[model samples]
Target: MSPIRTIVLTLLALLAFAANSVLCRLALNAEQVNPADFTSIRLLSAAFILAIIIVIKDKSAIRHINQHGSYAGALFLFVYAAGFSYAYISLSTATGALILFAAVQFTMLFKGWLAGNKMGNQEYIGLLLSLLGFIYFVFPELEKPSIVGCLLMILAGIAWGMYSLNGAKSTKPLYDTASNFIRLTPIAIIGLIATYFYFGLHISYKGLLYTTASGALASGVGYTLWYQVLPKLKPSIAAVSQLSVPIWAALGGVLLVEEPIELHLAISAAIILGGILLVILAKNKH
Candidate 1:
């Protein structure tokens, strides 16, 4: 690919990342669909679309799914999807994205430590800054938008972290994702069924459309594009590039969704994203 094409593709992939938060917030904020049902729809749609793509584009990815994916990965995938959907119920697009992004990095950093990887001074300092930033973002009542929403976003982030960790272990990223989503089907069904019994389904056609777009376009296509972009990017460039996601989401919220922004949110988002960027770059410096 040409340099221009690679850069364009990279930008598009980042936009897609931001789009997921915008789409989710738009749907949930409107109360169009229940989180559980939206999650099921999102997973099923993403699986269907990604499966078809892999079938035509690379069947080898699906050939040895058992070797590439795990139950834990599927569980984490489901948890991320569910928590993400629910968290958006009361959270703004930018705020939720920042919290989710921070939690994911923290989880990965903690997991690495558990796996016997020691952080350098910069990494340690970055981790502390990230934690402090996150706490400030969610505490003191005035800074918090919704305590429940914050916690749910954090859960989503951690789940996403586990999913990322597991996916990194796979030799084939596309195939691993396909297999994980396939495993996620039964789990999604159980949750949907339980949610139905309790809260019942809450989906209008507009809501269904939003959820479908989120799955097929924002997630399924977005992930494929990211995988394509990854090979073209330096690790540090990739890491730094993602810092745009929350910023984009926040801007999209302000303009497209008309969501209000608070000064504290902006400050905290900077601290968290800045800290994570430092940690990532520090690790890659070696």
Candidate 2:
């Protein structure tokens, strides 16, 4: 592929990932659908699109759908999806993305340490800075983020961290991801049923459209594109590239959703993402 095409695809994929937050916030902010219903529909749509992609790639892939993913993987994915939707109930696009990004890196690093991976001084310092930045972001002095939203987004990030780790050794990332989405069917159905019985169902056509785009284009096709480009990029480059996700989400929020960008958010983002960059660089050097 040409360099221009690669860059274009990469940018599109990143935008798609960022759009997930914007879309969720839009749908929930409009009170179009409850988080449970949004999550269920999102997962189902992603599953449908991913399955279609797989079938197109290899006609026989349908028969092997059950041969790839695990129940634990599906559970983690569902937790991430559900928690993410719920968190956005209160969190702004930028704030939720920042918290989720921080939580995911922290969780991944902590897991690595527990697995006997040694952290150098730089890594330790990076972790400390990240923690301090997170504290400052939620410290209640500045705009004051929602405590429940922060915690829920953190949980979602941790679940996503675990899900990524679970798939780290997979030889076929796209196939595994698709299979995992397919496995989410039963769980999504149960959650939707419970949500309907308890909270009652509420979904507008607009809500459905947003959720479908989020699932199919943003997540399903986004992951596919990312995996395609992964081989062409260096590991460090890939790591560094993700730092732009929150920024894009923030832009989308401000321009598309009419959300405000507080001064504190700017400062906190710089600190948190700066620390994450330090860690990424340090890891690559080590």
Candidate 3:
């Protein structure tokens, strides 16, 4: 791929990832769709789009779906999706994005450490800085995000991180991801059924529209673009590039939802991103 095309695709994919935060906030905050419905529809749409792409790309790949996926992977995906939607009920787009991404990075790094990958001093310092920054960001304050919301988003991030860790071993990432989404169907259905009994299904046309766009455009197509560009980029570059996701999400909140970025958020985001960048650079250093 041309350098220019690669940059454009990378930005597009990042933007798509960021959009999920904004879209979920928009849908849930506005009460257009309940969280349960949003998660179910979003997962279904993403799975459908991804499956179609796989078939179009290679018909034989369809057969691998059953072989590539696991119930555990599907559970992680479901938890992430469901927790993400519910968390957005009380979280601003920027704040939620920040927490989610930070948790994901730290989870991956911490897991690597537990797996016997030794970390340098710089990596440890960076990890500590990021963790402290996260704690300070969510600590009780006048304008702090809801404790419940923060915890749910953290859970969502951890689940997503686990999902990514599993994917790291996959030779066919796209197929594996597609299979995971497909496998999540039964879990989502059960959640929706329980939701109906408890919260009662409440969905609007606009809600359905937003979830579909989120799943199809942002998630399905977005992940496709990311996978296409991932192999061409160096590992460090790919890792650091994701740091922009929260920033883009913050920008999206301002532009798309009129969400304000407060001073606390700015400071915390800087610390978190800076620390994460440090970790990535340290890991890639010779």
Clashes of each: 0, 0, 0
Most accurate candidate by TM-score: 2
lDDT score at residue 227, model 2, on the 0-100 scale: 61
What are the C-alpha RMSDs, in order, of all predicted structures?
2.9, 2.5, 2.5
lDDT of 1 by residue, 122-198 (tens): 98888888888888877864455588888998999999777765655556656666767778877777877898899
lDDT of 1: 0.80
Off by over 4 Å in 2: 1-9, 141-145, 227-235
- Candidate with better TM-score, 2 vs 3: 2
Score each candidate by Cα lDDT.
0.80, 0.84, 0.83
Which wins on TM-score, candidate 1 or candidate 3? 3
Q: After aligning candidate 2 to the native by TM-score, how far in Å is the CA of 115 from where it should be?
A: 3.1
